[model samples]
Target: MSEAISYIWLGVLAVFEAPALFSLAGIGIPAPLVMLLCGLLTGIAVGATPGLAGPMAMAVSLPILISVFGVSADALLPVFAFLIGIMKGATVGGAVPAILFNTPGTPDAFMTTLDGHPMTLRGTPERALKIAHFSSVSGDTVSDIVLFVCAPFLAVMVESVLDLPEKTALIILSLSFIAAVMGASVAKGLISVSLGMVSAYVATGQGFHPRLTMGVEALSDGFPLIAAVLGVLILGEVFKSIFDMWRGIRRKRAEDHNADLAPDGLRPGDIRRILPHIGRSSLIGCMVGALPGVGSTLAATLGHSLGKRRHETRKGPTDKSFGEGIPEGIAATEAANSAVSGANLIPVLSLGIPGNAAAVFLILAADSIGGFNPGPSVFNFAAPEINPELVVAFGIFTLMALGNLLNWTIGGIFMRSMGVMARVPNRILLPVVLLVTLTAIYVQETSLAALWVAIGFGVLGFFFRVLEISVLPFVIAFILAGSLENTARQAFSASGGDPFFLFRSPVACGMLAAAVILVVLLARKK
Candidate 1:
């Protein structure tokens, strides 16, 4: 236990002892902390605006951040902290648009719009925004604590027994779980997952020769990872927004030029009334987020539905229920969604599987940066010497806590004042985002082929969105394809080319069977 505490202490000091971004009054300030603040503010602004989101900002900033930071081991903490801050801040800022202008910033925030806009209409916009910020930050803090406690313990336990075959089965299980629980139709989610696996396998896998490449020199090297990801996530979003606007599916983002209502605040009674909803929603969100591809949208929906049910039961159907501008409604939705930010990291940090888009970027950061490898091995406490990856893991935890601190202190004020950002026309924002994204890709790859790959994937993403298919399964599957293939191949080799190698281990066989059962059950239910 002392050893563990010693490592944790080192991790905490590592962040404070890092190279300073600047010196103030002869005291050096850490770069990671500064970047966290900067990213948090930027994320809040982005979330306040319509047609922008945390993942979009993350996709655009990643390549540019890499270029500036140079992918050094020391750069990892600062770079990842900023992304973490953006994710945390966006959860709070997303409520701004949903409350003040009746515009949900992201799909999950649609739950917020139910009671949020009603609050604004009833002349309690300030109170609505404050409720969102407080609940978001509180839920985020709870989830972060869960992450800090759970990830290392789970990683260590998994490391003790998992072999190549077991790991292979686990990856298959994760993909299956993601496909089964992700979208409206289990079939559509499976299709998305299949497409991603196919895309990821092109021109890359185990073996001396690249099997999928069509003899083109550029294809031989395969698609640029960053470009493909950004194209699908960022460029695809841009193209879809433009297409929607052109097709009249989306109206121009005209501000509701209504009178500024009097400011309101959350009284003690209000806090007392909303606390239970926030607590329950936070628990619900954490549970959902621990499973890969079960996104915050579902969490928000479940939180709101259950909160409403409980509220109705208590009020005897006569009191002001949910969707009637009650603070509990805002508390339920915001807390549930925001809690997903930290709990989503559980898979990324412990299992090396990304549960969401934010986790995807974090895994990408670890891969691109090198040095720090995430997985069960990362938490190896019996190492004869210090484990650097373990230190980095705890440093990430520290940064996350700092982000929550910022959210608690100044987030409400900033979010309340961000009502004007909702009016910044998407017409002006979309083109700038497009150009910057393209530039960031080129600067990273320094190749025209990368640009073309991004455009191609972006088109594919546009269609996927149009078809109402979930992108989470696709993105998660694409990222995991290589890991699955490598583990399977190694297992096969170890079994002396036995095709039934994965079944040799009872645990692995049971896991694989469970995966199949999950698919069948979900498909039938859907």
Candidate 2:
């Protein structure tokens, strides 16, 4: 117990006493805290804007931030702090446009629009914004507490039990599960996964003879990871949005909520009215976020549905019901989606699996920085001496707590300042975004070919969006491909070149069998 307490103390000290970003009047300011605020503010600003999101901001800033703050071991906390702050701030900021402009800043914020915009139309935008901010911070705090308690134990448990083959099978199961759940049909999701895996595996193999290089020497190193990830995600969306705008068929607006303005609206006491909804939805979001590949959209949907059901069951229906400018609706949706930001790290920190796009950026930051290896090893407590990773992990917890503090105090100010961002049209916004993204990729990799590969992946992403396929599976598969391949190879060699090495252990066999069963069941369900 003393050892544990000491380690936690050391972690906190590391964050405060580490290298500073800059000095003011001979006093060095901690880099992590500064970057956290900067990222959070940036996230809020972007999240309030239509056609921008936390993931996009994180993706764009990553390369640039790496350049500014060299990839030293000390830089890890600050970079991670910034990314996490973005995740938190964006989750809350997305509610701003949904309420004020009747625009969902992100898909999960679509649910917020149901009640949020209605409240705005009725001349109580402040109340709606307050409800969103309060509920979001509340949910985020709960989730952070849960993550702090759960991630270490979970990572340690996974480290103790899983070997190479078992881990390999687990990855297959995870990919299959993600594919099954993410899209309209299992087949389409599997196709997306296949495409991602193929892209990942191309030009990757032993030494001089890389597989699927197609006779191009540039292909020998494969596409740049940053370009491939951001291109498919950000640039692809840019293209899709531009095309949609050109066709004069932009995203359809929600149905009109101008009718039936209820005089009796969100009073200060209404916080009590929405408390139950917030509590339940926050739990829902945390659970879903912990599961790899499950995202904030589903959390918001489920929370809204449950809130509606509860309200109907309890008070019947009224002008101020779930979708009609009710505080409960805003509370439920905001809490649910905001909760996902903290809990999504469960998979990333514990299992080295990214649950969503924001989580993907977190993994990317770790990989690019090179000091941190996020997985079960991150929480290995048996190290006899001081474990730097453990200390850093604890520092991450401290930064998260500080972010929550910011959310409670000034986050509402940022959350409500969404109106200005809406003025920037997609025409100006998209091209600028694309230019910045490509420029950052080029600068970081110092390879012009990387830009072309990124553009190619962006086109592929555009197709994925047009076809209505969920991109989650594809991104997750791409990220996991290298780990999966390496683990499988190690397991194969350890098993004396056994073709069926994955089924050698009972746990591995069970997981592989589970993957098959899961796909079969999900297909039938689909």
Could you tally the backbone clashes for each prediction? 0, 0
- Model 1 CA lDDT for position 304: 95
Kindly report which residue stretches of model 2 are placed more than 4 angstroms away from their true locations once superposed: 23-27, 254-266, 316-319
The alpha-carbon deviation from the true structure for residue 57 of candidate 1, after best TM-score superposition, in angstroms, is 1.4
**TM-score, one value per model:** 0.96, 0.96
In candidate 1, what are the lDDT values of residues 1-526, reduced to their tens digit?
8878988888889889989999999999998998888889888988899888888788777777787788888889889888988898788899999888888868889889888888787778888888888898988999999999999998988888888999999999999999999877888889999999988998896577876787777788777778888888888888999887788785333233344355577766888889999999999999998888898999999999999999988985567889877899999998999888899999888999999998988888888889888788888888999999999998999999998999889877887888899998887888888888888889778888899999999998889888978777888888999899989989999999998999999989999999999999999998
Looking at model 2, the pairs that clash are: none
What lDDT does model 1 reach? 0.87
The local distance difference test score of each candidate is: 0.87, 0.87
List residue ranges in candidate 1 displaced over 4 A.
206-208, 251-263, 316-318
Cα TM-score of candidate 2? 0.96
RMSD of 2: 2.0
Per-residue alpha-carbon lDDT of candidate 2 for residues 1-526, written as tens digits (9 for 90 to 100): 6766877888889889978878999999998989999988988888888888888889878887888788988878889888988888888888888888887868889899999888887778888999999999999999999899899889988899999998999899889989988877888888988888998998886666788987988888887788899888888999998898889986666565565454434575888988999999999999988888878899999999998998888884444578888889999999998888789888888989888899899888889998788888888677988888889888998899999999899999877776788778878998888898888788878989999998999998999999988788998999999999999999999999999898779999998888889889989988
